[model samples]
Target: MSFRWVAGRIALAMLLAAGAQSTQAADFVDSAQRRVMLPERIGRVMPAGPTAEVLVFALAPDKLIGWTRPLSAAQQRFLPAKAAHLPVIGRLSGPYPTAGLDALRRLRPDVIVDAGPISAERSGFADAIQRQSGIPYIFVDDSIERMPLILRSLGTVLGVGDRAEDLAIYAEHAIDALRGRLLIRPPNERPKVYYGRRPDGLETALPGSPANEEIDEGGVINVAAGLGRDGRIAITPAQLRAWDPNIIIAEDRPFYDSLLHDPIWRTLDAVRYKRVYLAPSLPFGWIDDPPGVNRLIGLYWLSTVFYPDMTQEDLRTQVKEFYDKFYGDKLTDAQVESLMRYAEAKAGETRRVGGEPLVGIGAALPTPVPGPGGVGTGPAPNTGLGGLGLGPPGRRVPTGGMVPLAPPTPLH
Candidate 1:
């Protein structure tokens, strides 16, 4: 109801990395990837992704304008309870970008902080728009290696360099803590791991992807190495069999039942050995998607899996700190466990068929959709060359016909 009420609650949100009082602080932020530390305390902020939202919420709750809608059951479970009072900036799939020009003008936010830049709109100049609109724009990469740069950049823009520097130090220490436990070994000795990318089991990202980098950091051998270093690749059920990896990290297989009922997938050794692992959906995507600032949690989750003998006590505490700091919410022990389960990429027995990698960058790499950050519009799914026919969020596709983007939407 009152700004003060929201302020009292979110002053502790660590995920947002925001820090300000009332609305007095107003400064433009320019994050053109040339990140550096500075001394500015950004009063108002807009979240481009869940990670950015979390960052702002952690540091400055009263300052955050809005968050993306559909905050997932697990992610929402830990919200500050006051978030329900906030508006839905936009939905992830259904709505196009919700950072409205009018809203920015009305709110007159000092800066736009975007952490999720997909290949779709990587160079689309959302930053330039902020400049044109008399606001500063900032971009943070999804890689852990670059997060310190992002934090420092955000620090300078927000006049919270001390807090930002603390965060950078904390993040580095946290990552080092996990890497310290990893048992790096000969390539042959490392456990083979294959990661399924999304709702469908077939699509996967290769070794060079930031997704695989996190896995590689944990001392696990990615089975998808054969797929190449160019990031995600689609392969057949037969090719999967040929790989016959030691461990299968199955992703959000929305259609898990078919794998069991269908006779085709039974031949895989992973299914026979029952070494498959599963990662949580919804909230897990928060960690998995774009591998953002929140991905420190994902790194911890992997550490536990790769080194089953190690207890994740400290990591669990860190999760609590993060939830408290960013969302102003808390998770019961059980909820944290449940949230991490889906993040686990376990072994599964799935055989193969061969075809081109189902993953293709549509000719409309950054297809013009209509909405807050969109450029233009057309009828549903204006199928240009190599279009994925992504008509709308929940649009149903006739079975056996053409499935729109059988692969997972690009997380980057």
Candidate 2:
């Protein structure tokens, strides 16, 4: 071969190789600030945790390989039939053994996405998984406030910009509505609330914890706010009594079931006055557990509960709309009512406990009625907070001790 012809052939090979490289992968920065070269057209993905699963499913369900956990029978009812049948792949975090690594290799996802609070340990775990599986891993911030940005960025990374934009717009609007309405309430006017987790209701997230972000966004004062704690903390009955919250929000069904019968718990003003409420948790927790996009609906539910008259948006209608939009499930009236049963029950219980219906701020208190014995037939003085069933006045709850924890730094 002529030297010029041979040189031309070698140059052609180099150009082809470079073109292939460009087509195969592209570099992007993730929430952990890691610059990762991922497939240009990512068609398959695995979620590193439950939060990641929800995020990916919301933006690109067609690309998701499976779920971190199996859908329960009830949870299955809330999802598309095909999604309900997705295999249980487990998660990389939490107490259980790291699951689906072998399946991950077999399935050969183009990338793995881990979303939630970014931390050194979590970043390291992502790196380890990438090294082990030879798959690119992308970490995305899962902070509730940053969700819109996250969705936008993840959309660019996953080649689903249009769907992500739609989700992001909805998220931004919901968050704006929540902040615009709730943040203006004076500290004293906000209902004092305690959020209890676990079946026993002893484990709780303090204010400033990512887990309690929804409670704060809802405009209610977290009774555990100023305790200067992060993450889940176990509260003794005595400590709970000391806080004496006006309202209680429990995630566990068993805890709500036993609240009235449990002697120690019944002593709480929330339980005694029927101000305790069960937060909905089915396909996913509406409040915190995994702390993902699921909490956007939570903000609406809580705001309605705390200040019903502030907006005319009906909770049932909102719930149905949210589920249909995000979860791909069109809820029946019965399902919507069941999801809101706890809030409805609380309202009914409050009336039965002889409290007047809750009135909006600046609204006049109802006139005292003459009782059978000629005594005023109004709720006992100081027993409620402006007829909202928020227990007595003068009980001090934390107002503004939210710690300023920065998003986790990326590991070098």
Question: Which pairs in model 2 have colliding backbones?
Answer: none
Off by over 4 Å in 1: 1-41, 91-100, 116-124, 160-166, 183-186, 253-263, 281-287, 310-318, 340-412
Report the lDDT tens digits of candidate 1 across residue range 131-172.
467665555543554455456545545656567666666566
lDDT of each: 0.50, 0.66
Model 1 residue 405 CA deviation (Å) reads: 21
- Candidates in order, TM-scores: namely 0.65, 0.77
Candidate 2 residues 240-358, lDDT tens each? 77666667888898888877687877777787777778998867888875789988888787776665456656778778888887888899988887787886432333221222221
Let me know the TM-score candidate 2 reaches against the reference structure.
0.77
Weakest 10 consecutive residues, lDDT, candidate 1?
Answer: 393-402
